[model samples]
Target: MVVDDHPVVRDGVALLLRGEPSLVVVGAAESGRTALERAPGLRPDLVLLDLRLPDMLAPEVVAGLRTGCPQAKVVVFTAHGDHHGVQAALDAGAHGALLKDAAATDLVAALRRVLRGERVSDPRMVPGTAGNQAALARSGLTRREYEVLRLAAQGRTNPEIAESTGLARNTVKTYLQSALHKLGARNRVEAIGKASEAGLL
Candidate 1:
């Protein structure tokens, strides 16, 4: 199965996989909700999941897939390889991750490797560098913290965030402060910037 928001990318990937006699494209979806709704019915052995969907972030989609279709293996297919995104996806149970720029052959090989129960990632996105390692360490933001920070990044006030997340205003503030401290930011602006730089937002 292939899950990507862009029609071009979805069609392109379907075309690429169609050429492989050993592989078959069982389904495709344009949104995270649609993907989750289809997973149980399709029960695909492998899922090529785009990191940024129109309706859901990569981690949310990955977590949903893991819970809804535990038998399916998920590989994050993304354009941005920021540490936070990659780490979050992996932490959410993605078997591997590949950048959108990956060569067709590399993408096929990655799918094969993941099917064989091997974890894979593009070398460039690997957390081998000190900066990447540090970013990975900081990416341990709880789901609530991430939610608050993501909303805060959109210029939402604490009350707005609370209303959106269904949490109390004080709880929203607590999550925001925790996110800021974890991101080493003194203010929401700095936190948003850092989160963007780390690809958390």
Candidate 2:
């Protein structure tokens, strides 16, 4: 199954996959609600889902599909490079995620890998490879630290972050300090730049 808001994308994917002897284009949907409504009935082996559907968020759509069709594998197909969306979708039980710009061979390989009970994430989006891990270790920020940096990247002050996160001012400061140290940044601005480059913001 193909679930994307754009019909051209959907048609392109369906048409592309239809040429493969081992694959079938079972059903297509333009919104999360429609996908959920039709998924169980289609009983597709795999669903190539887009991150930005008109009716629902990516994580919510992933979770809904998991609940609605436990047997089907869900793979996120996104054009954006926001790691938050990728992380959220994975956390919500998506089998894998593929960038929209990925090659045709990579797309087929990702789908097959997911069907075989493997988890695949584009390295550019969620780098979990050895080199990426080494870099991450040098600046290994926790989820809380990432959250703080994300807010800081938007020019939020400690008090603003505290208020937004319901954390105390001192706690926000602590998180910011930790993040800065991990990213080898002496100040908030540098930290934001490093985090953005690392795809953590």
Candidate 3:
């Protein structure tokens, strides 16, 4: 599946995906709404989602899609460099994410890795990977998801998140869900506090 607002980008990526024998260009759409609408029926093994769809944020899109397609893997493709956005994608339950400008081979490899049941978090462009769980508890969190939680704690809205990130709004929601579940919180506010208590934010 390819969920991007841009036809050229979507088609280009589709062309690339078609080349891999293990991969398939299952579906393509210009918006998250359309992606969600079609994805359930397509039963795609992987979703190559874009960060700039016209409806719903990418994180939210990822979350919704997961509920609709529990077995499908999601891979976020975007040019946004905000580490928090990358984390948010992971938090949203995305199997992987990559900068849109990343090498084509990188995207292919990421897809393969995610489909193989690997968790692929983008390394922070900075010095440390902070999203991993704090050592005090028997907990686990990818470094990227932690970044999403920290930013959500800082009070950024989904669109504000888009401005600050390379991720789409739905992808951010996915991160929120992952964080909330990990913290055993019922909502974002509680998730924030719990993550803070765990030194996750």
Among all candidates shown, the one with the greatest TM-score: 2
Task: For model 2, state the Cα shift of residue 68 in Å.
Answer: 1.6
TM-score of each model, in listed order: 0.64, 0.71, 0.63
Model 1, range 1-201, lDDT digits (tens) per residue? 999999999998888887787778899999999999999999999999998788998889999999999999999998765435677788889998889998888888889999999988887653323344455456878766876787787788999777655689999899889988888899999999988899665
State model 3's lDDT.
Answer: 0.74
Q: Tens digit of lDDT per residue, candidate 2, span 1-201?
A: 999999999998977787788888899999999999999999988989998888898899889888999899899898864445767788888888889999888888888888899998887664343354444555677767867777788788888778666688999899999999988999998988887788565
Off by over 4 Å in 1: 126-201
Location of the lowest summed lDDT over 10 successive residues in candidate 2:
126-135
Tens digits of per-residue lDDT, candidate 3, 14-95, equal: 7777778888787787888888889999999999888657777788989999999888999887766464545566788888
Which one is best on lDDT? Answer: 1
Better of 2 and 3 by lDDT: 2
RMSD of each candidate relative to the true structure = 7.4, 5.8, 9.8
Q: Count the backbone clashes (under 3 Å) in each candidate.
A: 0, 0, 21
Taken over the whole model, the C-alpha lDDT of each candidate is 0.83, 0.82, 0.74
- Segments in model 3 whose C-alpha atoms lie over 4 Å from true places: 124-128, 131-201
